[model samples]
Target: MTELSNIPHALKGLNSVVVHPDFKFPDADVVLSVTGRCLYEKQLLVDTDIRSNHSESGGASTSDDDEDFHSQTSRDRRKEREEKNNPEKPSQATLFKVHKSVLRRASEFFADMFSIPQPSNQDTIDGLPIIYMHDDPIDIHNFINHIYNSDVLHYLPLRQSTFNMMSSIIRLSRKYLLLRLAPAAMFRIRSDWPTTLEEWDKNDLQVVAITRWNAQVRDGSQDGGSRLGPEDLLVEPCRVIRFARQENILEILPAAFYHLSRLSSLNDPHRPRSCIEGRKRAHGYWMGGGRYATRSVLTPADWDTLMIGKAEIRAWFVNFRQYGWQSIHATNCGADDPSSCVLSSQGGWKNYWDEVIGVQTRKILAQDGLDVMEVLQVLRHVVLYDENLCSGCRVQAGKIVGCARTEFWDCLPDFFRLKRPNPWGGIWMEGEPVDCFEQSI
Candidate 1:
């Protein structure tokens, strides 16, 4: 039997996986043999040179082309001989001992499969029937663990490795029609990458706090070692974008795309290199003077979507800067000189934007255009707390912010050229959040 190295350790409180069949499962009546081709197996054969050393003879008539042809012919002959001599080789496989009732209850595919009658000649391992599964053993292990341990879904939101584990379960569940498991996994992903503006604002505040902490660390005012990064609080948007597109999770794409757009270093392969150094603020950020490349890149279509969405976002900012406060009426100003309050405060706001906010936006973002959502938050704070602005203007500014954020969230799908999904912003109850998983299940 061939041995496979680097088998993962069993997850906490779960032990349904084994690299070999020798390990016993007293309660398991069936053995699931999961097999996959070992990529390393062909490396030795491919690296070995099949050519023989030629003799150093001036009179030797074998041309260089002839030698090349002969070398390839010898390699082909050896491959044929090996194939004929060994028709089959033992493959690397993992054995999973699990219950039929658990599988049937979890998956429609397995339920239907178990309902079929089996032949008496079927292969058995240790007097138990062997079921061969072609999926990755890691996926199978996670799938079985989820079925046996209901707490897996219950504690999913709190787990640091939620994306990897939940995504694996989602892939397997979708394939096998595991009704309950997929919805739970989907709910967790959506919750993490919110669809509603209200929920996204909550997540954004956490990101802002992390950025502030990181900023303090960078300026030598705080311990550098104690700094927090965006990845600590949220999944990388590039990975989320790919996964959402693959699973048809339209609700998450707006936030994912918006998150990616805020990054200063997302570059078009066909575009110039002006913003490569700006990656420090985005997905593949720089840390401790070293570059850490993000794992995924957007597809061409996604790149187009990002560009369009960014253009729209920057355009919104420009429009807001020029005319967002035009609706403010002098009659609503609380100052004794209402006209002076309205005109002076408006002038103060625009001047502050041009001199401070605009310059800072240009400096920080560099090549990437304005981060519209973040700037909106900044605008909200400035209007509310700036001493120059009257209380009346502050209240009106709050209303404008509320309306703009809602409009932006609603138009995100249109911006990205995506068809909106049903329950786009999630279904909320009167005072409690509904169990989306139960309804879908």
Candidate 2:
């Protein structure tokens, strides 16, 4: 619902994370990848040299290069280059020294593996067991990173690469059934692709997502959008759809569809990434890398909702002029309410066409995309801040806007031609359906 509340004592929160309370996950036992040379092996020899001289004074347990999560981030490429140039760097693979006890607490998968009846026959580098994985080495590394930095609110950096990392963590967390991890992973997911109106109010997350999105799509941005694909945040509603479906996160679909409709403005599937090069770069981006490609991620029913929902929202804006909403007006203007009684002089009855509420409403509708909640914000701000309206009438105006918002929400399913996820009495209908995709994953 909000950013995490943990503050570090170091830079404390920047590029760093707090350890779990039981943070005794010492020595990485999981050997993610074996290298040609012992990266750690070289560092140990240097540390030994430093410590022997100090032994004559007072010996100390010094910090090692391979300490805590082994910043293996970019070192793999560097390690490869070094091995190629100097073929005599002691041919050994990289090793991770991790704690089996900590892995057991975080992952039931590991717990089951450890519980299997066998001689503790696994290989080890430094007394710690080496567990090899068939998963992408990058993903495995990112998952282990979270285990080390699982501090609340201390999230990974908000870069495009981070989004890739997030995708990995979500899948891994769900697969491993990491009970302690679901909340943090899901919170990040919710911030980017919220399903509920309340979650959509997180402006900070929106700003970051949109900024990153704009950089990647129509024409690439100065943003590192090159690394981000259409399936990435710049334009991937399918990503959210698959993730929510996989995780049984049913609530994310509706709001995600809302964002998708707006996103469709930039993403014309027939358009190529080549069109937006150079000068066309600053222009709006279409996140749908391939229209058919993105649509394939959703079930037919979900696809119908998105298509109908988008058209219906645009239709709602057009029909506002002809909708005959006269019955919804309230005229019980309090005796002291000058604004209400005086509007008769300007016009017989107030409407969006009236000079008072004119143009702005149309301006919002005319904007490239229609985000219903955003429209409501514009409407509310106009009504609440109008100096022409009196206190009592302002209160009444707010009531009217509230009523209209409720009405809009209520009719959403009907507008979208959807029977499920309806706002029944302003609440989502329970057990609508999330099994649309019965994937083995």
Go through the candidates in order and give each one's C-alpha lDDT: 0.56, 0.50
**Model 2 lDDT-worst window of ten:** 40-49
Candidate 2 per-residue C-alpha lDDT over 270-373 given as tens digits, one digit per residue, 9 for 90 to 100? 34456555323223333333222256668887787777888777776555433322424545455464545543334433553355444556666665557666
| Model 1 lDDT tens row, 1-441 | 222233333211222223322122346677777764321211111111111211233221344433332344336546545545765744345566556887888899989988999898776655677787878655665566566655646554322245655667788876799898888887888877887877888866756665555444555534422323323433557777888888878778887887777765543222333465433343223232111224247788888988888877666555555445443321254567766564355465456446644664555434563466666676667666757657776766666655565666666665566666665743443344332212211
lDDT of 1: 0.56
Query: Candidate 1's error at 262, in angstroms?
Result: 2.0
Maximum-TM-score candidate: 1
Per-residue lDDT value at 336 in model 1: 78
RMSD of each: 15.8, 12.5
User: How close to the true structure is residue 54 of candidate 1, measured as C-alpha lDDT?
Assistant: 19
